[model samples]
Target: MDARLAPFATTPRLVVKIGSSLLVEGGAIRQTWLASVVADIAACRADGQQVVVVSSGAIALGARRLKLGKGGRGSLDDAQAAAAVGQIALARAWAELFAGHGIEAAQILLTLGDLEDRRRYLNVAATLDRLLALGAVPILNENDSVATQEIRFGDNDRLAARSGQAAGAGAVILLSDIDGLYTANPCEPGATLIPTVARIDDVAHMADGRSASGLGTGGMAAKIAAARIAVQAGMPLAIVDGRRDHPLTAFAKTGHGTVFTAESCTSARKAWLAGRLTVAGRLTIDAGAAAALATGKSLLAAGVVSVDGDFARGDAVEIAHAGSVIARGLTAYDAPDARAIAGARSDAQAAILGYAPRAAMVHRDQLVMV
Candidate 1:
């Protein structure tokens, strides 16, 4: 058992990344291994932890149905077709695997842009939050059917890290073909496993390229990159050997993993809002709103004096007061709606917007003081 995984027991929320090799073997799903994973998830849930799975197997599963292989699926369209067929099977497999545990599995497919765009990022995050609140496990994958080369994740490692950020996960675990990062490629003579990586640069030269499995894309290099992405957002990430059945059940007994410690301590969600987004619009609020916001309260429409620039709902916008920008957050309403409801009280919001309306122009949780 690796003592480093001690953090796993206390993680309030965790994102688990299962690569193609871990889930599929010889053109078929690894049913028994997947069942063990479900057991791990059920145990996590019992301990009151929220779980999100970022799994990769759709293309592999779809390829089998379409009789396509790496060489057979030469074109992007062909790959997309394979993914279209396999996505259904992949979702069904997860749903069925979790059925016995009395849990609902929610499928969420995304392109690279979904996380790159601030508006879509918020929408994705909200859905994840709601699904967890409803006690459902979210199964996320790259929308391979629709994703072109320009917008594809290419591998699930980085996607898992981003999904962890979006879900505000306390930690991320990458179940892999190999146990952990090695001092050198394990295939080389005298190469040894490096159990804990405190900094990526120190081990940057140790990265071995390409996956050993035909079903997976990411290799040790990719996992290193993933560790960089996750740790920057204040969460540790673990790369563990997952070839064995009931791996999670035996996690405490197996000390074969590379644990990456986070260098920063910022909340993943807040860090994204603080620096990653490009502000799309600005809202000038009254002094009252400024006062309320300083106390960590949500921005109400009644406190808004005016709206500037055009932005749709869920877009990141700056909140200003008396010509000074005080905070930035995702707006609940679009520019026109925000304008129409400016200075309007909650009682009159529906009449102003022609809908029941989402309360709070900007939620405090999403807001970051600048």
Candidate 2:
């Protein structure tokens, strides 16, 4: 193990996600625990490291405060109601904690749309950049009160991974109830902790049918998925126990956690594009277009051989050649418009479509080189 690569030993931009199980105890927010976490954030900032926090526990806090049932899982409506009530309390607690240390904290609630849409995605990134530039800590959380099943971050694990990509973070630390990943259930005989993981896929095989403790929603499965996202975006990740004393500080200094190594680093735009779960349409380009894409060039209408599916401007679409996808991008024009301009020279776009939105079917900036 490289000592410098340990979670606490090195100085790098980091995104730390603390789950509900860690923030709450006996169905209430643990103020002492939260204070420790805030202190750790203060320490990181003092070292000139940028930190973003993705937190879960709004619903839990709200449920407790509203006296809505006790423990166990709640209905979707119940969860949403709890989130609505608890989000304010969550922010207030975070604000107070940071204020104690003379640090400013900004609450940023985001839904899936904030990440999936190109315009919204860029806006979120810009906002975060500005916050960090001003030396303020940004507290991120999924906007569960307004998000439906169709558009949700699903869990904070995934949200933290996306936030790391958005902020160009060098590492993401997942503070969970457990210490680290194990080869088998830690309670079972012969199970052992796997301290370092080069590939997240390997850890997935070990997860099998495990589920998280009653206090949290995410299981080993979600953590592995988050690690995969971070690794692909060229951001290393560590899953460590949050219950420990000075958890974040200890991890940073000792690197004592389950570390997942990054695979390949990608730019912010490309990372956002690659992380997209769905594509709205497909653009079939010719061999020449494929060659041009491989060499990092814009996709001109003249090189497009065909268009498939109905996609509006700014929608995610796949760029293909001979039925194989070569790239993916946000479309510059809608489906019908793209079809009319396909195979036409760039200068002839206006003549063919009677007013082209853009000369290129997919501008280089909008396209992700796969």
Candidate 3:
């Protein structure tokens, strides 16, 4: 056990990548095992953490439903067909499992292109943020029904890493059939688990490209690649055994997983918010609000003096004070609504907007002081 894995259970935002090999077996979903995983997720939610799940089982489950040969290569059409059928079952199963714990589950299907394009990436990020803000856990999987080799993420490992990056997850957990990385395939003799990876390349040769289960597409190589992507993006990742009951809880308590540490990307996130955004409009705030933003506080509607521009919710906008740019951030309300609520108290949000949304016009997490 290692203390380094504690963040996997304690981080404010987490993305858990569940492999199909661990989730499905013998032509059906592993109900008992999945229940245990759900329990772990429930525990995380109970601790006030937001979680996003990148699940891989649609193709495996679909193949079973269609009576396709298990663990064998199939035509792209066949794979797509299986995904179309299996996705429904997978989503339903996840919904049911989370519902047992009074948590709502949302299904989001995407392809590589969705994440590769800048505009679509932002849209996806916004959607995930909204879902988390609404107290719902998003269950994501690749949209296999229409994906081809050229545009598809060959494995869910990379997809999970990218999804976590887009959602700004603080940590990622890869629940694989194996416990963690080893000098060699653990199934083989003389392979010992490596508890921590400081520099992935130093041990990149250690990956034997072994996939523990026929149902899962990713192997050690994929996991390593995922680790590289996540770490560079400032999100720590962990690879742990998922076969046991309450695996997440166990890993946290026993520190049994291989933890890949990475620095937080606060400056990078702020830079993106400040420079990469296309200013959709402007929000003129009072001097008090400007000072508050300088201190890293979210921009409140109470401090907003005027709203200009035709920006929609989630669009990036400049924050102005006395004809000077103070900060920039994503708006939580549309231009019309923002105008109506300018200079209003936080408590009046619901009454003024006809529905309760966020308290801040620009959340601190999405704002950058310029």
| Clash count in backbone of candidate 1 | 2
lDDT of 1 by residue, 1-370 (tens): 3457776667889999999888977778899889999999998899999999999888788888888868225678877888898889889999998988999999999998898686788899999999999999999999989988888777789889888888988898999989888887788899998889888779977886688886677888888777877887777899988899776666656756889987666655566765333477999999888999999899999999989989998888998998887787888988998999999999999987778978689998888765
Tens-place lDDT per residue, model 3, 86-200, is: 9999999999999999999999999977876458888999999999999999999999999888788878888888888788788899998889888876768988999999888
Reference-based TM-score of each model? 0.73, 0.80, 0.71
Alpha carbon lDDT of each predicted model: 0.84, 0.83, 0.84
Candidate 3 whole-model C-alpha lDDT, 0 to 1? 0.84
Model 3 alpha-carbon drift over 4 Å, by segment: 1-3, 264-370
> How far is 70's C-alpha from truth in model 1 (Å)?
1.9
Q: Give one clash count per candidate, in the order shown.
A: 2, 5, 1
| Residue-by-residue lDDT tens digits, candidate 2, 1-370 | 4653644445457899999988877667899989999999999888878899999998888888777774424777877888898889999999999999999999999999898887887888889989999988999999888888889877898889988877777889999988889988888999988888996656687764244656556878888888877887888888998887679878766767798887777677777887775688999888998999888898998888888898899888999888777688988898999999899887777888776458578888888765
Q: Over all chains combined, what TM-score does candidate 3 have?
A: 0.71
Q: What ranking of all candidate models by TM-score puts the best one first?
A: 2, 1, 3
| All-Cα superposition RMSD per candidate | 8.9, 4.0, 12.1
Measured by TM-score, how close is model 1 to the native structure? 0.73
By how many angstroms RMSD does model 1 differ from the true structure? 8.9
- What does the lDDT come to for candidate 1? 0.84
